[model samples]
Target: MAGAIAGTAILKNLSPSKGLKTITLTINNDCNLKCPHCYLQYGKESFLVGELTINSIFNSDFEHLAIVGKEPFVNKSSIALLEKMVEKCYLKNKSVSVITNGIGLTNLNPSVANYLDYIDVSFDGGKGTYHLYRKGSFDKIIDSIYNIQSKSNVTFNALHTLSTGTINNIDDMMSVRRFADFKIIMFSPYLNTLHDGKNDVSIVQLEEILKRLSQSTDFVETKESLLLMDIYHTEQEGVSTETLKELMSFYQLDSKIKLIEKDPLNYGIIRVTYDDYVLTPYESIHPKNYTKSPYLASGVNLNQVFETMQNAFS
Candidate 1:
């Protein structure tokens, strides 16, 4: 809870009025992987699309940046954009991170490797679990991580989708630890609204798994503490509704979890799609009813736009 407050406080200080720090910008919706849990709903046709420019990002005031997907590397221009951002951030002393499928690493580009401060590669369940949802080239993803590590200064971490089928294999996660410095994150399947009610994973089940995982592995970065905090503080107005409150309480969350303030500026994720600037508290775009604001601004004044964001957050 203290770190949560510290994170939020730093975000507020960055742009106190706007309270923005972490910016999640999507270059495009295109991704090579067809992970079943992917919320983007992307396919082959989508991969052909491209991303926004690094020049566009330089105009914003974000201190911490997460270049996310649909697999960011699928686009030919992704490396170019990344290089530009990295050089700019490095010169400005800013921190940048990338979230990828790891397929792009087979012939890793040096520019990307040099610029990133941290890289998170998705590795849900060894090769079998990866192939189940992410389809094709599992070996390539593993190889890509090795390739990036050999060539870059960036820190690499493995990200896994925690599902009923994948959760039991803690050994698979431990296997990845030998190859590189990695951290396992439990994937929350409930965020996917596409799932029919019958097959959905319950809050209780998620809690149990978190409890087990917390006790069992140091390889897995414990995010259960964060979830517990979410259960409490995230229930207030503007964060969650009365129904959500009942649900959190019903799960007996008050005893197990601690709540933290929902820092609109610092803590949540923000995305830039073709249509608008998107913001969500979590990864799933649907459950939160993605908030969009037009990217179109009349005046060329960057300061004016920053002022506008400040007013909106205030």
Candidate 2:
């Protein structure tokens, strides 16, 4: 089978723990809620990635994979794809991870959670602040966390997007650590591509809150994570984003990027969109009209796509 051959090629070169790692894929474009901040070019009815895309993504010289976009748990096909990723990861001792809104996570099939290394649940904030943007019960989100933890040892990370609406959510969101077995609570800045004047939260104000959090608990992430979040939300509003290149130098991610330059086969960002196979640095949750993807995402030999990425980024 094509997938088997691809997995074999990945096994041949990747050590997972030591060799190359990190492959991100948008499994499907179907989600239950319509958040005001959603920027994906496709909508809920968009098609999911096919078998060739799955094999091509895993076959690359990568060890870890990040599942994003819509909600992968909306159907069984997404679960099937995740299971395949997990199985391959287990064989190579690699890792597969996903970022979900936590609605379907409540009754998430045990087989899927067993193979994942990380599960990031996006909880905007506690009940009141949570419902402002996301639809669904905060209780259900918490239940989803318990449901998965009861079944697997996967590290649970709470992903809260800091926006104008949830500026005061720090207190309630961090409280997740008190009740749940969350390994990390990552509060990242929200990028307002629509510029609809709704998510006009201040960066300086956020930094101050982060400072407060640092003094409050050990659950807060390192300075690197904060910087990474800032970098992710930074916009290209005519100010040259080249300074982002310097900001990236402050983190361990810098090391992984160095490997990408040294050997595209070993390390580099591979992003799978509904219509294209993209490489990061050039990828973003930017509005479709303002996208800056460096290459097209396809289902064919994604490994070879790295050569083109290396030439551009490296």
As a TM-score, model 1 comes out at 0.67
lDDT of 1 by residue, 10-80 (tens): 22233334434555555565667666455554222343222333444556666766666656677667655
lDDT of 2 by residue, 125-222 (tens): 76656776676778778877887788787767776655555656666766666557765556555554532123324333333434444443332433
* lDDT of every model, 2 decimals: 0.49, 0.54
Misplaced by over 4 Å in model 2 are 1-20, 41-44, 194-267, 287-300
Error of 1 at 255 (Å): 15
Candidate 1 local lDDT, residue 224: 28
TM-score for each model? 0.67, 0.72
